[model samples]
Target: MRVNADFTKRVAVHFDRNDWIASPAAGVERKMLDRIGEEVARATTIVRFAPGSAFAAHTHDGGEEYLVLDGVFQDETGDFPAGSYVRNPPTSSHTPSAKEGATILVKLHQFDPEDRTEIRRSITGDSNLQLFKDSREDVRVLNLSPGEKLDLDAVDGLELFVIAGSVQESDEEFSVWDWLRLPPGARSTALAGAEGARIWIKSGHLSQMI
Candidate 1:
C-alpha cells in the first residue's frame, strides 16, 4: 500500500478528522497521509485514541517519531500532554495509550540506519520560534501571529507541516494539519493567517527513503 510515495515530487494535504479509519485496535484510529508497505511500513499519519484505548507493547525495528496534538499520551515512562514531541529510535519498544484520549502526528520507519538518539521535548509553553538541532538535520517550530512572515532559507529536502491556524507559502495557503515537502535548494517564506499559525519545519533528510 502506498500513498504519496513519490520522493521527488512534493505532496501536500490537509488532515480531516472524518477521514480517520479505525485500525485493528478497538479504539485507535488513523488518518494516513503517506504510506508504503503493509502493516509494518514506512508511513506518516495522524492517529487518535479514544478514552481508555491502548496499544500493545511493540518494537520499532526502524524508528518512530510523534508530536502530541491533543489530550494526553501515557506510557510507563510518563504522561505527555499536547505539544510534546518524542522520538523513539530504531529498535525501541513501548506500550502507548491514552487515559483521557489523544490525537497525534506520527512518523514510522523514517530514521537513518545509524541515527539512534532518543529525544523528548515539551512545546506547551508560550508560542514562539524554537529549533531542534542535530548533526543530520534542524527542526523548527514557528508560532506566528496574524500577518506575520517568517523567512525560510533554502536547504536540502525541506519539510513543512501546518499544525494549526493557517500559513501561506508564496501565495498558497494551508490550514489545519496540511503537509508539504520540497526538494534540495528550494527557497521560501511563510506567512501567518489572521488567527495566527503554528507550524513545524524540518530539513536535511534523504528523500528517497521518505
Candidate 2:
C-alpha cells in the first residue's frame, strides 16, 4: 500500500482529518504519512502504543528513527520519555514497548546502507534543538513565539511536522501533528499562530532516496 508516495510533489496532511489504523500488534495503531511497500515498507508514520503493549523483537535491517511524542517508549537500550529522539541504525535489534502508553513519529528503512551512527537525545524546554546533521540530511526542532516568522530554504527536499501549536504557510495553517513535504528546490516561509508553534524538520534526505 502507498500513501503520499510521490517524491516530486508537495503534500500536506492535517492530523485531525486522518484516521488511525491498527497494526498487526494488538493495541498498536498507526497514522501512515508516506509509504512505499507493504508490511516491511520504507515508511513514515506516527505510531501509538497502548499501556502495557509491546512489539515483538525485531532487527532494523534498514534503520529506524523516531521521536517520542508523549509518554514513555521502552526497549532493551533504555526508556525514552516524551521529547526524546532516537536512531537505531541498520542491524540494530530491539523489542519496543510502552508501559503507560506512548506515541511516536517514526521513519523506517531510510538510512544509507553504510551508515552506522546512533543518536539519542531529549528536547527540554523552549530552546531549539539540533537533532542530527550530516551530508545527507539536517534534522532539528524549532520553537516559535507567537507571531514569529520562519523562512524555509529547502534546496534539496523538505519534510516538516508540527509537534505542537500552529503555523501558517501562505493561506494554510498547520496545527499540532500536521505534516508537510516539499520537493527539491522549494523555498517558502511560515508564520506562527497566536499560540506559537513547535516544528520538527528534516531536509536534504529525500534527494538521496529519489
Candidate 3:
C-alpha cells in the first residue's frame, strides 16, 4: 500500500495522466499519489465525484485537508467551489457530496496532534488574502506570474501544488494535477506557464512528517 512512501527522496508525479481507480464509495474515484495504509490510511490522492454522487458519513481520526480543483464540493458546513482550501481537524466527521460534480486534491491522516486548526478559504473573496514580508519568511496566497520565484528560508521548507496552469522545477514539469514537495533546506524555483499559474503553498512544515 506504499506508493512513493520514501520521505528522504524527492518525489513528483503527474496525476492527470494516471488511471482513475474506483474507491469503496459508489460513484467516487481516486487517482492515488501516495498511500501507506488500508482503507483509513495516511494517504494523498486526487479524487473526483460524479454528479449526484455522495459519500457516507465518516470520521477522520488523523484529520483531512483538501483543495477544490474543479466544480463544487458540499458538506454539512456548506458548499466549497473551485479554488477553495479546507482543513478538517482530527476526529472530525462529515458526509461529502456534489450535485454538479467536483474534483479535489485530498490529503488524509497527516497532521500534528497539537495543530488543531480548522480552515476554509474561498479564493474568490478579496478579504481572504494578505501580503506580508519579514526577515525569516515571505507568505502570500494569490496570483503568481510566470518566472516569479519564491525563496523559503533555511529554517523552513516549501510545499506547492498547482491549482492551474503548469509549474516547472529542475527538469520536472507539473500540470494542473501535479504536486511538488521540497525537502528541508532544499532550494527550488517554480516557473509558471504562458497561462500563468495558481498555487497553494505551505512553508515551515517540513519537520512534521507523517
| TM-score (all chains, Cα) for each model | 0.89, 0.97, 0.85
Clash pairs of candidate 1? none
Model 2 Cα lDDT, one tens digit per residue, 25-124? 9999999999999988999999999999999999988999999999999999999999899999999999999999999999999988778999999876
- How much RMSD separates candidate 2 from the native structure? 1.0
lDDT of each: 0.82, 0.92, 0.75
After superposing candidate 3 on the true structure, give the runs of residues whose Cα lies further than 4 Å from its correct spot.
125-142, 152-157
1 against 3, candidate with superior lDDT? 1
For residues 17-103, write the lDDT of model 1, one tens digit per residue. 338888988899998878898779999888999999999999998898889999999888889899899988899999999999999
> How far in Å is the alpha carbon of 58 misplaced in model 1?
0.7
Q: Which stretches of candidate 2 lie over 4 Å from their true place?
A: none
Name the top lDDT candidate: 2
Candidate 3 matches the true fold with a TM-score of: 0.85
Question: Which of the two candidates, 1 or 2, achieves a greater lDDT against the reference?
Answer: 2
Model with the higher TM-score, candidate 2 or 3? 2
Residue-by-residue lDDT tens digits, candidate 3, 1-210:
888676555677777678899998888999887788989888888999999999999998888988898999999999999978788888889999999999998989877655566888766542325322333223346456776665534245555777677877786787787877676667767777777667766566544553
At residue 31, candidate 2 shows an lDDT of 94
State the displacement of the C-alpha of residue 201, model 3, in Å, after optimal TM-score superposition: 1.4
